[model samples]
Target chain A: MLFDVQGTATDFFTTVTSDAVRIDLGRNPGLNWDDFVNRWRVAYFAAVAATPTPAGTWTSVHSIYRRTLDALLDEAGVEYPDTDREELTLAWQRLIPWPDTVQGLRRLGVRYTLATLSNADVSAVVNLSKRGGLQWDAIFTAEMVGAFKPDPATYSTAARYLGLPHSEIMMVASHKYDIRAAAALGFQTAFVARPLEFGPAAEADTEYDDAFDLNASDFLDLADQLDA
Target chain B: MLFDVQGTATDFFTTVTSDAVRIDLGRNPGLNWDDFVNRWRVAYFAAVAATPTPAGTWTSVHSIYRRTLDALLDEAGVEYPDTDREELTLAWQRLIPWPDTVQGLRRLGVRYTLATLSNADVSAVVNLSKRGGLQWDAIFTAEMVGAFKPDPATYSTAARYLGLPHSEIMMVASHKYDIRAAAALGFQTAFVARPLEFGPAAEADTEYDDAFDLNASDFLDLADQLDA
Candidate 1:
């Protein structure tokens, strides 16, 4: 099972928001940290989507996130210092896993191999998984493949390295676009809903979609559905 | 900490020999499984040593091992069936971990980020590590980098993906050549002597060389030496 890590397993909003608030505690107070984090997420999505796919021209997700953070801060007319900006950007490397994330992975891991196929840089995935106590049998990241998810090269390269046909590999993700891309490449798809992914106030698409091969409320439900 | 997984962490000798014995129990009974495994290891070393390092021309260790297995079996005049030959070759994917491998890694992991930097194919390393219950924060395999160990690309590429300065990353291995290659690239070196890596009768080097940054008898001793 290949996991889409950012929002599906780890709660990036909480981590980025918490770090923003902590960094801006006395220096840059009254800024809506939550909104800032949400925008940061959206900006990150836009940055990756806009990135070109050819191998040598690829920029790492870490560089893109840092650049996005700087642009947003500059646009908001905030004077968050360089160190704090870096720390906040690095917050992506320590995102906390959801309550059921670890247990559910442990359950599913018994019957299947688990790995990350994320747009995040290799270091970010490694550090985040280490910090979150997320045990994966292997890890595949955009840094190694030189392309972000939704780019066919990302999934195709990982499939090559895994030495497994696309049919045997299931893409388990919370986002429809991610699973859809994997499904396009003949990969089995499992959609796990993270209703509060964007935040408590934001409405995330939580309804089960029959387009995916399987759908579940969360990882635990996914494990149960797969009988793992 | 970057580990050389095959002999340093996992007992490839015992695993391969046991599989060979089981596969050749009724037929080819007189063949010395111990000698066969040692010769296989030697041949694997020679095969990887001969491989060129340019990216696209590189071959996976899995292919090398499988080819080497076929050659050795054919030379021995043993009529090992294709299925048994394939199964025996797959034994490399299920190598058993050394006694202190798991416990020592667990201890060292608290203070350091542990990862595998192996000559093995990604799938083989992943499968063996999973079966052995050996936990690593990240995995860096030769197959991903398009070169085997002792080639500068292998070490440099892994260090790049790790996002760490070569000075800060320590390469830990049982073989001096492996650590020496890492040391040449400015990585700190740790030598863990595996006395039985070849087999009980073999004169495996268990000597401590001051040339390495540190040397220990086993993973536990290495952990203790590093105060992990």
Candidate 2:
């Protein structure tokens, strides 16, 4: 079993609200929640898209997040806050799980060796698992492979850690990109729809148009599909 | 939540019966179950006591088990056989939880973050957790630290990985040595007594006189003490 973090198990907006208030009041005098959310979105996607080049050049997710956030601040006619990037990163740690996440994961834990194969670091995943009351057999991270999702090596390494072949393991997520990556590598894929992942009235194009092995509307639905 | 692997979870002697028969058939050409049990007792303790020192450079639990079996053969005046160690180890994988273990662990899991900090490798522990229907928040192993139990680093690292301070985490084990070590490192200790860990008639020392934070007759007793 697998899980996603932000926008899946956790509410990205709630986490940003508290973090924005904390950061804005402390060092940044006029930063607003909307500005923080937009900057965070830019940072999040930039991190997902950056990659290493063939010339041995490396572009880290953290670096991408930092650069993208800086550019967003500039575009918004605002100066980049003098807050520590590490402190900003720690905001991700305080994310609240979705309403169904805890109970759904508890149910799944009864049958499968549930794990999180997300882009989150091992430490972040461990912290989230503890706070969310999620029991995971193993916590695999992009940090372990030094690469992000859509990389076969990450999925293969996760399977190796689970002591199972790719065919025996399943990757469960709300993101088609992640599920598609695992599917191409021979893993069973399950999708959980997150209609409000980007917030109300935001068009997410929440459809698994790509060929995925299984799709569900929520974690409970995923559990039903797997158990059935 | 912790578990005692031997009689508390699985019948150790019964599981290894085929392995014992194969060894006897290849070596002495004829040996009884009594002889096999005797040899196994020596091998098991010897395996436990033969931890590597700095200069000695201890081996992994897998390698130690292999060497211990070899020594057992030599002591029993038998020859080494080509019996499958992996298959024999898989018998360990199929361990049955004591009638109380499942209920006890389920109760404990409701309150605390349950995990297995075992001498068993990650794969072995994961398999046992699956087979026993155990839902652990994390499954840690000596393999993570490349060191066995009684090492402070192992307990400390396990606690650290849980994102908890040593005092917040607890070490639960049947072995006094494991609890003592963990207690010295500031982790709360709970000892679950297993008088027949060695054998029923074996006259092994059963009293846990160490200063463990809590000592109980069984996992259920432990659950009671922990207010689970």
Candidate 3:
């Protein structure tokens, strides 16, 4: 549930397959990974930025991410292909859990409830849990709430579902923006540092402040910090 | 925080302490543990039975239990010393984990999300998790939804908050009624056969059929099933 893109799971960008995707772009002379990434990023932001606020409240991360993905495909002039959006979405379901994730979560499991409050769909999370060998009493996602993280409702709803007070539940994430919103709502927060989340340190913003209740280098360190 | 009332935790039942006020129930000229427990049981059920339902919904365990206690005191012509209620409540908060609960959860934690969706309040669940040394990704209770088990809302709310579909979430319980309701709402269901949940050989009417996806004799067995 507390996952980052790229480096957290498989080193996709460095993998032969991902490198091939990049190579294909490079060979197109007019297109490159950087340009393609930039274009997708722009479309992602534009789509999220354009979403109408509901009853004066901001749009949720769930909505933003979903719309962002839609916009990126549209702007790229690419169709979803035979896999369709649902199967493509299932990619998240089969993502490899980080090498340390299973053991770390196992250790933490000795002392706390471990769940992923991700942007993935419920079925995706279920399949991911099954495939990754990650067990959770619950797997929460933005899709369930029809909104995304950084939204108070998402965190609050999670706590409410767990039958816990906001203060009693802790939101552990690799993103500051996610933790900041959780903290504002009175939930305890833990930061799991995923330095190469976006690719490499040079391309990633790996710096974070000591604003969380606890910060760790990885899931194992997090387990140590929680005394699991 | 899977726990048994009599054997697991030291703090659950009311202890006969000199500091605690005693209601001399004329029926049991002498205060015995059995007598006290019988009276408490009656108070507990009566309280639950008296609660006013919402529309078609039933009264929650908390409301029923608290009210029942209050009414029992009134019927016995006894006034509980202020300390008595606090001590009794504290006892509830102090339930000990079953011996297998901690280790079993740790094992299951390696493969699944483990949580307590109980009738206990959030505080009680949190405290139990801490006292019993059990780690749950989330702890759910009726207080979160303002409704008790067997109500569709409780399960639905839990699924929504965890960002999971009802089907992806599984409910593990000793009570058949709870499992039935959860299954009815599309949650994967498992029943832990607490044959002695009520007392020695006093079966709890735990009949298993197609409703449950898995049924096991204990937490360890549940772990094995899920792991397999």
Candidate 4:
């Protein structure tokens, strides 16, 4: 099984926002970090969207976050210390796991080979998995594949390395677009819903679709459905 | 830390030899299967040695083993069944780990990130690690790097993916050639002494080389020296 790490397994939103609030809130009480973090996530999404898959130079997701954060801070006129900026960028490497992430992974790991197929840089994925106490059969990243997720090359590259056909492998993610891309390439898709991925105020798409091979509310539910 | 999985952490010679004896001894009581397995290992080394590190079409270690086995059986006029040959080839993927492997990995894991840097296919490494109940922070293989061990590209590619400099990484291996290549690239080298690597009848090198950063009798010794 290939897992999408960002929103599916780890709570990057809460982790990054908490780090931001802890580091900067005392100095700027009026600054709404929730909105700032939302903007940061949106900027990251845009940066990745603009970058093409392979055939040219590849920009790492780490660089994109660092670069975009600088641009965002400049626009907001927030003259943060250079150290703080670096620390916040490093925060992406140690995102907190969702409540059921560890337990579910432990359960599913017994019957299935679990691996990370993330758009994050290989280092970031390794650090995140290690920090979260997650044991993966192997760690794969866009950096290794030379393309981010949603690219056919990314999914195909993972399948090739695994010595498994796309039809036999399952792609698990909380995002519909990721599963949709995998499905297009003949991979079995499991859509795991993370209701607070974008925070409590935002409405997440927790809908079940027959189009996907499996649908569940969280990773534990995913494990139960898979009978792992 | 990067590790050579075959002889350093696992006893491939014993595992393969035992599997061969179990499957073929009854059929051919006159066959010296131990010598045959040794010859098989030597052929594997020669095959990888002939292949270029990069710029050529890369062949996986698994493919090399399978091909060489067929050639060996043909040369020996063994007339082995195709199914038996396939099963023998699969033996390399589930080699038994050294007695100190899993426990030492568990201990060192608390203080450092542990990963495999072996000349095995990604799937083989994954299967071996999972089956052995060995938890690595990451599983890296020659297939992922496009080169076998002793090639500078193999070590450098791992460093590139890890976002770590060569000086900070330690290459642990029973084979001198592997650690030598890693050391040439500025990586710290740890020579692990596996006295019975070739079997009880063979004299294996268990020497202490000052050229390497450290030398240990086993994984547990290495862990203790590293204070992990």
TM-scores for all candidates: the values are: 0.97, 0.72, 0.62, 0.98
Among incorrect, acceptable, medium and high, the docking class of model 2 is: acceptable
lDDT of 4 by residue, A53-156 (tens): 64436688988999999998888888889998999999899899999999999999999999999999889989988889987899988887777888898999
Worst 10 contiguous positions by lDDT, candidate 2 chain A:
A53-62
Candidate 4 residue B149 Cα shift, in angstroms, is 1.8
- Against the true structure, what is every candidate's RMSD? 1.4, 6.1, 7.0, 1.3
Candidate 4 residue A190 C-alpha distance from true site, Å: 0.4
Candidate 3 ranges with C-alpha deviation above 4 Å: A1-70, A80-84, A94-147, A153-173, A182-193, A208-228, B1-67, B73-84, B90-117, B122-146, B155-173, B180-193, B201-203, B206-227
Stretches of model 1 off by over 4 angstroms after superposition: none
Chain B TM-scores of the candidates: 0.97, 0.79, 0.75, 0.96
Root-mean-square deviation of candidate 4 = 1.3
* Ranking of all predicted structures according to TM-score, beginning with the best and ending with the worst: 4, 1, 2, 3
Candidate 3's C-alpha lDDT?
Answer: 0.58
DockQ of each: 0.77, 0.37, 0.15, 0.87
User: Tens digits of per-residue lDDT for model 4 on B1-228?
Assistant: 999998899998899999998778588776777788888999999998897765435687888898999998888878788888888999999988999999999999998989999898888988998999888999888887677778798899899888899999999999998999999999999999999888887778899999999999999999999999
Provide the TM-score of chain A alone for each candidate, in the order shown: 0.97, 0.83, 0.73, 0.97
For candidate 2, write residues A139-198 as lDDT tens digits.
666655556777787888677656688898888888788888888888988888888776
DockQ-best of 1 and 4: 4
In the range B92-140, model 2's lDDT, one tens digit per residue, is: 4555555577788888877887777777656666776677676666667
Worst 10 residues of 1 chain A by lDDT: A52-61
- Which rank order by lDDT, best down to worst? 4, 1, 2, 3
lDDT of candidate 1 over B1-228, digit per residue (tens): 999999999999999998888888868867888998999999999989898777456587877888999999889898877888889989999999999999999999999999999999888888898888988888899888887888888898888888899999999999999999999999999999899999998889889999999999988998899999
